[model samples]
Target: MNLKTIFFTIAFLASFHIFSQNTYVFLGSYNRDKEAESIQVYQLDSEGRLTKVASTTNVINPSYLTISPNGKYIYACTDTKTPNAGSISSFEFNPKNKTLTFLNKQTSGGENPVYISVHKNGKWLVNANYTDGSVAVHPLLENGIIDSMAQNIHYSDRSIHKERQTRSHVHSAVFSPEFDVLFLPDLGADKIRSYAFDENQKKPLTETQIPFTKTDLEAGPRHFTFHPNQKFGYCIEEMSGSISVYTYKNGILQQIQRINTHADEIKEGFESSDIHISPDGKFLYASNRGKENNIAVFSISENGFLKNIGYQSTFGDHPRIFAIDESGKFLVATNVISGNVIVFKRNPITGLLQKTGTEVKMENVSCVQIKKYY
Candidate 1:
């Protein structure tokens, strides 16, 4: 074959490989009755359209969900009221049958578990407890089931505002880019605390851990997102509905900017819920609940700053969290109270979102994560 012919053949093969991958979206629903006890799954096409693939499985109050690194198991946090009595469950994911088989359940170490994220090595599972303000690290068994707690840290910093920042309320727990430090966003403390992690040797961490605190006392930081390049991080303030950008270097975050999520003249009572950066690191999206329920979009400037682009109505009330497809063509915003997941088409060039009118019926959807399988 000629030189040009060989180059064309290689390009075509690379494009074909990516197109053959099947993407799936997992929705985590909170069932207070503890009857259904499962998660919902949907299939995503190349164009980012979703089709129901599997019915809801049996799991309990899955407030947050995360997939295993090998895609063999799924983990979730059950938001229960009993103090230090919530749970984290594991399931075997069957992509062919689009079903989940129960594996095991382990104590979450705290009450009101809100978020769960797995370590990069897939050996540890981290959880954020909202009620008691703690972070738990659980180990995974060889069979892909949860084993037990590796480390459980109880935050006692009640050193901020009184109304909202009375006690330490760990809202989120995520690993740094190098996986050397684990950062926990505590809403009630108005700070994001960082701890040095040792995966090889299970050791105890001290209370003198480094922390990042917001200027406003009642800001109530909720969710945090890391840049694709791993050089920057962004945290959304739930109470004040604002975004804080920081420079992440050597497991430390230095404040860069704090931008408001709501318009200056149009603020009457709103709280932020979820915050996510685009797959390509070009845009950021955050959910605002309360009187103004909308998803605010922002363009990432050259210096890693967020420039407010626009806001799109979620078409429902209380949009807690949303997920973006792997292809970056669609975004599904989960409306917990409105009982629907509003689908929107995302423009790649402009980083703007347009409603697609593709709504999925769901009850109390709080979290979503996308997975791709052949």
Candidate 2:
């Protein structure tokens, strides 16, 4: 090759390597006593190591977080148990400096706001309140600031579990792949409620005639996620420690299978927390907290059924949430009780995880999110 051509090729490869070397990670913590900051930002190297970049401390009980579709803003649920005291806060994210600037906060319309999801159109923010059993929708301004609650719906129903299901407890609010429907998983009601979402309307969500799908009595649906194909949905049951698979079509969900997240030998105290499917849709993963501090791995069949592959120990306590990187190359688990984050290298071919021996200590970390920063 000519000397000039070889030089240009070397420069192009160097730029690509630099672009692929790091990703931005954001962590939310449940810090009531001010032991640690509420939100933290870090740089995650390709080898799965974390280096602190920036942190903010004003927000309280920032247990969960979701990023905007444009990657310019982050929304977090400020989980407070006092009546009508919960709030959702928005922050502007700067990829250049890895810092977050507080934008604004608004009432969540209920207590103990736990989960937040942004609409694909970047005009709506939906949050689920766990303590007061309600769903709140907020309007997002063009500048990424969140306005007051546009709509709030309360659920009064209760399930069979007397103590835990005394009232409705909405654990998560997730949007469908097409962003035409919203699913709210109620941990205290044993049901997954669906709502039609229309971004064109002033009030974007309305109850459909077929509003919800019921799980087994006292099953306690905690979180819901959709398959990449948009034809299937899965719910992680917090109380039963099982996953319920369903066929989703035009905002309707039909249950297809229910499988245990724990081994048969380990029966009690299995509290499954979060669920995610691989980027390629070849595998599924769920986190178990109570007695079995591990992540269950399942292979996805062509028909959308899940087969149990194996489990990997988290090597920590109370893995409240875990996230797979956008590249599908690494998995990180944030252990709430242990106050440590564990990194696992994922095998793309086998769909299994191996510990990378990279741990970062962050007190009361409850959620971890990874995204590519360009």
Candidate 3:
């Protein structure tokens, strides 16, 4: 090829590569019926548009998903709702083809496994069962198949609420940034239960010196996340519609502040669901589902306190889960009742969100996880 032709060809190839970059989005959902897809995949392009790529109905009610640290495997908390019917399913992600292949599954040792957390080393897989009020641990094989349940711990504690707190309901399993501690937010018990963990141990989880940190009565602590700085932790309360802020260290937590998670003048009956801090650690967001279907945004201080910024309407009902991509440029939220997925452009500096992307419709979309496939 001539030099002029070579330059033009190279420019065209570069443009194609940029246009084809992948932002693989994994969405999990409740089964509306037998034919519903429980887990689906999509590509999020540069313009905040989400285009369907592939989907799978291999598992039922894969409500929550977690990608392995290496990003080679994906695990889902499948079979939610029914008693004794929950399981954790694993899949191998073929990034080259942008597809997922079923690997293996193991009983989560309880029903309604709503959350899964894989160890940073990728050996231990932990999950929390909401219906059965239990926590289970499973070992991961080299090929990403989940082994049998290695340990199971059942919690019988009850909180003040007669209906919602009749028994412990573990809402999420989150590991400390250091991976040395595991925190389980038990919604029904109104506490953040924690454990000291070492993946090499036969039973990796052991209770910490402070087994749990009590929240307000009937607060219903749900999803938990640590600030990127690793100095603070936060959890969204489903019942109280609040975010409890804590200073964390040595697998223990000290409550520093508690702030409302709903929009101004909008209170009561807000069923809060997910909590996530921005990659820059400057912003924190929590989703409310019931009455006020919105996201409460906050600005973070150096001392780990939060100031309410504003709220963004999710424009859908029951936004059960939301995820911020690693770039901190796009935020995706999924609604279960409306069965719609919406992507928002994020302002990294102000921590506000704007609805500018494409909207997608999925059945019972309950969870969203975003990862770049480059």
Candidate 4:
């Protein structure tokens, strides 16, 4: 072959190798009968198909999962409703084998731990317990093991909803983009509470003087996501089926706008579960569970307000959680009631999702997270 032919062949091989890299998809599930593994791992191809790779048994209802910022560890909040029975488990992730090695488990400081987030620095792990209306922080050892609880805060406030908001129910604990603040959304209290986070300190978080931004009575803030610019935040209100946009500065949140997630009239039983912003920050997506069973798509304006674009059917039931891959090429929604995960191909320009014809059957799948591994 000529020198030019050799160069072209080398370039083509290099591009093909990069395109063929597989992605690791981690799933968290609610295994009530102990028949299914609580955590499972799958390999996702470039076309969005999933093939099971590894699974760990006996995790006992690991309904939510989060990976460390460095991608070295996986953290899961075990949903146990008994008083003080809830716990968080740590696992050392091996990207080579697509397996998780159990590290150690610790008390989650309350019951029914539903959500967990690791600090950007990977030194701390924070979780929310829904049943007992509490949030806890745990120190992380260098080896991916979790130390005893560093702090646990409980709430007693209640909202106007008599049946659902009878008392405080903390749903999500997330850190700001800069890691200077932490936001805990209480679904039962209708409040998005903020705390000053000092990663250098032993505890690392304390209630801010201007502690919280309260949503409308019975709004039931469940999960929140910050815009890529760090200038705005969006909270998905579970009870009201709306998204609240807020101006965020120096750890304080000021509500700016509240818009419905459903395209039609707001009806009962349309519960919103999770919210995520596209990697490019041009679009925002939220999963609606009950009667709608679809993912709402919105265009994010330069000023951070959301414009409803459209909705895409999840092709399953009760989409409790959904994740957008880092490349922005694929999206996956986990249907907890349907026991399946549906994948979609995203239109980057229009911000719409089309079913990719890729589905994986897993019993009681609740959370889906994706990471690219070479």
Candidate 5:
């Protein structure tokens, strides 16, 4: 064969080798009142089969987790420290045994760290501290472990209502698709703060900080989901159990629609929990925790509008987080109060979910995240 043909054959073989590997799921559990909590690992085979593997070798209540793009490392938020200050821990996963080893830990610079996210380039780690109303950024070492805090910012703003928006509560911070902006959702402030992501600096250039387009005086936005195409975004409100959808273009947000997650009426103490979009960009799902513990499904239009499809019971109480497998064939809901992870089969075409008999046993499971591995 000629030299060019030989090069083409080698490239095709390398691509096929990487594609044959399967995906894995990592479940981060929060043991609120207990010690010695761990990160659970599970493997997903090519046929969509799940097999539980060995748990992480550390003891920390990792309420939230963010995996690296190359699938080499995972960073978890440990929120069980004193006076309520939080910490972030790093781990190295071994696909041979499907176990993780502790690498390092650093202070998150705040309290009740609820969410963790890594930049697409795997260079920076960001977190949302719920209780202390702060955001922290850290630089990741070449070995996929956190080095230390690079920047920490305490957010302050006006609280319109006394009931829910009494103080500042930073729930989650997520990077935009282009990695040029960071969206900070503060539940207590009832607004999403947008900041320009600086490529040359460690911290965000807050001089360009801009608030949400449609502010809910007391709606309490908790989590956000970006569309697959990166043209639009949606946020779920914890105070009112509603979703605010917006169009995002050129780093600006334009309000498109706001829809309620509840079917009929919301009672006194209802609060929404988590929001996620389908892998195919055809549906959106949000969890509601109140007298009724259920997941509301909404169909997505090509123009990025949402329409309510139906609701399904979470099977257990207080379904705080749910994860859709990478193949979009399964949805697992983590019922925090009930200590059960209920699995459901999802119909991608119809956007309907069917409950599967499989479930996992864990104590105070707060977050579920899945990724593919060999």
Candidate 6:
């Protein structure tokens, strides 16, 4: 073939490969069936629709899941809500069939594990047990099996709230952007704990110099998200309906600002669950589960502070967890009580959402994640 013809052929193939890439939506739920369908994988199309393609029943309560850094495996929190029966399960993901094959599991080190986070190197994983108020670490095998629990740390502290903050409840253990630190949010203790992580060590997570950052008196910090600039961290306070902004550096976070997620004054039973930033770093969105069934949108200032800009009603009960497509085109939320998934088209410029009329039923869905696999 001539040079001109060859060049044209190569360009066409590259374009085809880009457009043919598939996007997948993984849902973890508190499903009634422990046999299968508790953790389902769906194919998300360009037109913003979800179609289920595969599922696994090997886990009892895969309420939370984390995709490995290499995107080749999935780790889940199983046996949730069963006292002292919590476990972390592993699976090998087959991209061709869009399925997850069960690998191995290890005790989660506490009861009612709520969240799991895998390191970027894919060599270690950690989980937060909500009921027993502890954290567990496990190393992942090269072949996708989870090794025995490496270390388990239990916290003993109490916050101001007599009802909910009576004891320590570690909600999530999130890795820093560089994967050198782990931030553990303790809901019942009103603190965001920090740890220095070294995956190569026998115990990968160790307490840092500034071990924890205390939140407001009744602010039950549930989840945290970092800005793309890596200088700012946002924590969603569950009971207070607020977001705490911090300046993060070297495994330390200094509080810079605290803003309410709701439009009105803070009240009881707000139950804010999740927080995320847009890919472009211009907007932040947080899900409110109780007292308001909506998403609170904020405009992120250059100084890393947030201003409440708008709100979008989820139109379903208990929007527990939501995922923003990496492409920044869609936002999908799982409403646990209503048993449905809602898809919304995102306006890139305005950082707003509009329902796309592509809702599906997935009873008791709890957590969601979206990714594009080439």
Measured against the true structure, the TM-scores of the candidates, in listed sequence, are: 0.91, 0.95, 0.94, 0.95, 0.90, 0.94
Candidate 3's TM-score reads 0.94
* lDDT score for candidate 2 against the true structure: 0.90
Taking the tens digit of each residue's C-alpha lDDT, what string does model 5 give over 37-123? 567877654334457876764556788887888888988998544465689998988776667888989999898888999888888
Tens-digit lDDT track for model 1 on 220-315? 888998989898999999887799999988777888899998877766575888988889999999988877789999999878899998999999
Off by over 4 Å in 3: 1-20
| Count: clashes, candidate 3 | 0
Candidate 2 clash figure, as a count: 0
- Residue pairs with clashing backbones, model 6: 35-57, 36-57
Model 6 over residues 1-374: C-alpha lDDT tens digits? 99999999999887545533577888898875666588888887766777888888857878998898777888888899876598889888887877788888899999999999998888899999998799999988898899988999999889888899999999998989999999999999999999999988999887777899999988999999999999999999988888999998887899999988886854567889999999999999999987688899999999999988899999899998999988888999989899889999899988999999888888788989887787
- Looking at model 2, residue 361 earns an lDDT score of 86
Off by over 4 Å in 2: 1-16, 19-22, 82-84
1-374: candidate 4 lDDT, tens digit per residue:
99999999999887545544557789998886555677998877767787888888867888899998878899998755545589999988887766788899999999999999998888999999998899999999999999999899999999888899999999999899898898999999899988998999988877778888889988899999999899999999998899999998888888899999876765677699999999999999999998888999999999999999999999889999999988888899999999999989899999999998989898999999987765
lDDT of 1 at 343: 81
By lDDT, the better pick of 3 and 5 is: 3
TM-score of predicted structure 5: 0.90
How many pairs in model 5 have backbone atoms within 3 A of each other, for residues 3 or more apart or on separate chains, i.e. clashes?
3
RMSD of 3: 3.3
Q: What residue runs in model 4 are displaced by over 4 Å at the alpha carbon?
A: 1-16, 81-84
lDDT score for residue 96 of model 4:
76
Q: Tell me the deviation in Å of residue 169 in model 3.
A: 0.7
TM-score, structure 6 vs. true: 0.94
Estimate the Cα RMSD of every predicted model relative to the unseen true structure.
2.9, 2.3, 3.3, 2.1, 4.9, 2.9
